[model samples]
Target chain A: MGSPAGTGTGTGLINGMMGRNNIFWHECAVGRGDRQRLLKQKGCVVWITGLSGSGKSTLACTLDHELHSRGKLTYVLDGDNLRHGLNRDLGFSAHDRTENIRRVGEVAKLFADAGLICIASLISPYRRDRDSCRAILPDASFIEVFLNMPLEVCESRDPKGLYKLARAGKIKGFTGIDDPYEPPLNCEIEIKQEEGACPSPSAMAGQVVSYLEEKGFLED
Target chain B: MGSPAGTGTGTGLINGMMGRNNIFWHECAVGRGDRQRLLKQKGCVVWITGLSGSGKSTLACTLDHELHSRGKLTYVLDGDNLRHGLNRDLGFSAHDRTENIRRVGEVAKLFADAGLICIASLISPYRRDRDSCRAILPDASFIEVFLNMPLEVCESRDPKGLYKLARAGKIKGFTGIDDPYEPPLNCEIEIKQEEGACPSPSAMAGQVVSYLEEKGFLED
Candidate 1:
């Protein structure tokens, strides 16, 4: 391929350069700051982790509604919902579960980079998996909210009757039954029952909203 | 798991219900329409495809800048850049390449669902891979922009020096070299050399911007 004449026109076009290992990182003029300015809100990831039936999805939807009503843009990345699409290839095996969390973390980072509040709701029972997700986000941008409901409470609630299945040996490896759930050691927000009465969905959502507002995530 | 008193307390908390297949679909009040209204723009995927040296990334960045200047949000998902992050486990095998494209398409769909204009720049030489991406987006939102630069022109440019390596048999299965690059038959926009000269980045970006403007993608 010693075509000299054709090479002359080709050299005049490319603007992006090769980084280490032959990878090209295109430098864009419009960046995260520009996008956040346009949206009038700082981009961040709100990670909600809990056992099954612990209100992770409910709180995520509630928080999303609260933010949207306040003129803020938000997207909820529900773990179960994503199983129908992005993470459908993944299964319940340990390796597959870690890969699912890794993929979800990367997607959430992209959404945050695009200048939106990303709410990720998952029964991420393992602490290391949830920590890895936190490590990927920007500093102070990964707000970890723990649904600290007792296993007894969650099992009693049994929204999907999953506890019954797990207890009856119909569903093995279900969190809080055969599977262990390592609670967050230092989460940003924690919602738990008070006097044995669980908080309403709106009340739980309001608590998270106040935290976002106080942290200046609601403003550019 | 059959404790009646615990079930009574649990029934008071859950706000979401089970859907078909026992999957819980958390109903969020904040939908895509609400997000678009907040951003004042419609979400869409602008897929840019061509040979390695066809200036796909350049056009994507230019278009991103142009759209951001007009107060619209945009994100560019460069294929090479993604290799270092979300798709690092993948290699150059045909199966891996297809999986790579699939994951990127899924991420692009998520970005569009988050109400941002997503620009995806890649060599994506296969027609089937591109069409699969098209099937995921909403109607008229997957704008495939073909960079139809001649192979001679791209080989001449060799921006990343990949062509030179490929010619020397150092790099195997390089697109437009050993691997075939199937051009799009029904692309939404085609950018090619004009009068034996390439269009300036702004000019190329303007064409796509004009199409987006006309398609009501720039507004809610």
Candidate 2:
């Protein structure tokens, strides 16, 4: 194991010293600023959280379209959609659900770090998990949009027939049914779809975009 | 549970009654191609893999600088740098190492999917693990650039002193020391840094950029 040729510190090609932290860590690389400069827009995570069938994915898609049409780079990290791919290994168990959100948050942070607006649409029923996501992002980069629709409205608008299964006891621990949904206490935007008439997904998306514009996020 | 008002299905506010498989999964959202079109470039993962101190991160950073100068959207996902943040929970155990590469693979795939040329530099050590990464990307998007430097050469160039620790048995399962680094047999690009004189990181990065250009990945 004692190879004299390799052990000689002075004979090394790069000839660097050996303190664990003393290694020439190249920290100055292409970062968020470089990407944002190239793309001509700031990156952030627009976390859209709501109950099942509360139009989270639809609203994310609508917002993505609005941003893309305006020459802004964006990506949507949809919950159900990711379950078909990256989060396929995760299940509905509490531990698995937490892990699922952690992975999603990490991925969303990476996308934002790469200077692309990331619209993360998940039924992140827990406030702690959402807060953890917010904690990972840069300041003023985590926009939480609570789809403030009533559970009754979401049940009525169950697009995936998931509420039916949950109601029939076929799907256990369904959020807002058998499980509790903790809404965000201090989210930036709140779309009250249950106020009177349900707003179209586009209108809700426009509202969110308007919020971003008002906050100067949509500007250069 | 048997709420007639919610069970009627026609009483939905969104008014979109979807069969279990009929919820037209909004697949036509802003996709990779759309982002590519807007950016005037294609997206791919330029995976630079080798033993520790083989200049993998340096090459990645150099390539990123080159691409950024050329107005290409690029991001570098270095191994040690990420271990401090994203993969902080992981360790150097064989299983943890494999899991580490797996997560990095998934993140790189997401980047490529977002229509950005992602430079992933990691001492991934295992052929099967790396092959798994290649499988996740779309066709011709996984550019595996094997930094073909000898173990002795890498040891001499020990930038992180990780090699020194591994040699002294302070660290276990270090690639090319106590562990194995399976060299690529059929890699897309192999830069022989061991042959004759070792090329500068920028020169090696130029080789990679040239290969990407040859493959039409750097094209509009």
Candidate 3:
């Protein structure tokens, strides 16, 4: 908290005036260099995109846990939880969805700048929006992991009853229902849940870790 | 991820739902209850509040590192970095300030629910807002630590040039300048930054860890 008495009518103004002069000379003394030095590793944003019930959130959370267990700094931005706060104002409309991804992308950039790997899980559904997020991050800093699943499979596993609601017309503009889901043409990693028995969430996360290790993101 | 194809779409939704039911149920059946088990410890939020020029961020980062270095799990919510995303829309107004702390409290509660120690460092000025946050959390869950530094001292060491801007009227509603800062009424721990003496950031953070240990938050 703060000192309430410091805000006396005249004293507040005087302190305000004095603070300006003090600030002018204080900038050169402190820097983020020391903080970066302590961080020791480059940061990145691994964006996991997929349809509802496609295991994107699970994979992101698992990856975050794995990285944390290994002493690597990491964080996860799950779509549903994000809507509860940061992107709360946004809706499920295409425009709102784009803005949501844009905002998440910008935040991920800051997290990476602070030297923490940021994992974002969302049903981006639009290739253009995903590309825009990629543009915001540095080259190779944006790792897109596409959870490629058939629409039928996604609906079958409607973990949140979203697919059913969309089918009932209760949820309009649902991706893979009334709306479209443009798959990532060239993602850094693609999880083919159908090709084999879908890999465990940890296994999918391990693929991400492998990519980070190959890209020199993880310290050996 | 998810299955590639094969499953009824609309009418036979009930049958298709079986696949998802099995997947999640199986996961619950086999998943380790590690996180759930950890919540049995003394629950609380180690609220780290201080001036931006002070070492709140550094201490938070170090404390998180130390806690994780041990077997204890922790999640840090930093002020500057969080503003880049979750609180991007909010400005530094008295009202917005309260709302910011409110949102953080909700998130910290979620982290605590998931059995992780939550460390939040913000220059939260209002005692009412902080007290409100503490109210929502369980009894003894609020460990308020005040980073007590003289305004002149903090201004002299303005790390972000924010104090300078506030003085020049370049930034409106700056804490300790245009607005007021209400120091904690009875904080659990207070770090005083003196003219010729001060504990290192790590040492200061160690005091917090020791308190948590004494309170039985950390394992022996």
Candidate that would win on TM-score: 1
Q: How would you encode candidate 2's per-residue C-alpha lDDT over A54-123 as one tens digit per residue? A: 8887898889999999999888887765664566666677897888898888788878888888999888
Order the numbered candidates by lDDT, best leading. 1, 2, 3
lDDT of 1 by residue, B73-168 (tens): 889998876775688678788998888898888888888887889999989999999999998787888999999999998889888788987888
Clashing pairs in 3: A2-B181, A2-B182, A2-B183
Chain A only: list TM-scores of all candidates: 0.89, 0.86, 0.82
CAPRI tier of model 3: incorrect
Q: What value of lDDT does candidate 2 attain over all alpha carbons?
A: 0.78
Estimate candidate 2's RMSD in Å. Answer: 8.2
Better of 2 and 3 by lDDT: 2
Listed in order, the DockQ scores are 0.38, 0.26, 0.12
Q: lDDT per residue, candidate 3, A112-211, as tens digits?
A: 6545577888888899988988976766989999998777777888876878877887767778998888999999999876565778888898999999
List the candidates' TM-scores in order.
Answer: 0.90, 0.87, 0.64
Query: How does residue B203 of candidate 3 score in lDDT?
Result: 87
- In candidate 3 the C-alpha lDDT for residue A115 amounts to 54
> In model 2, which runs have C-alpha deviations exceeding 4 angstroms?
A1-26, B1-28
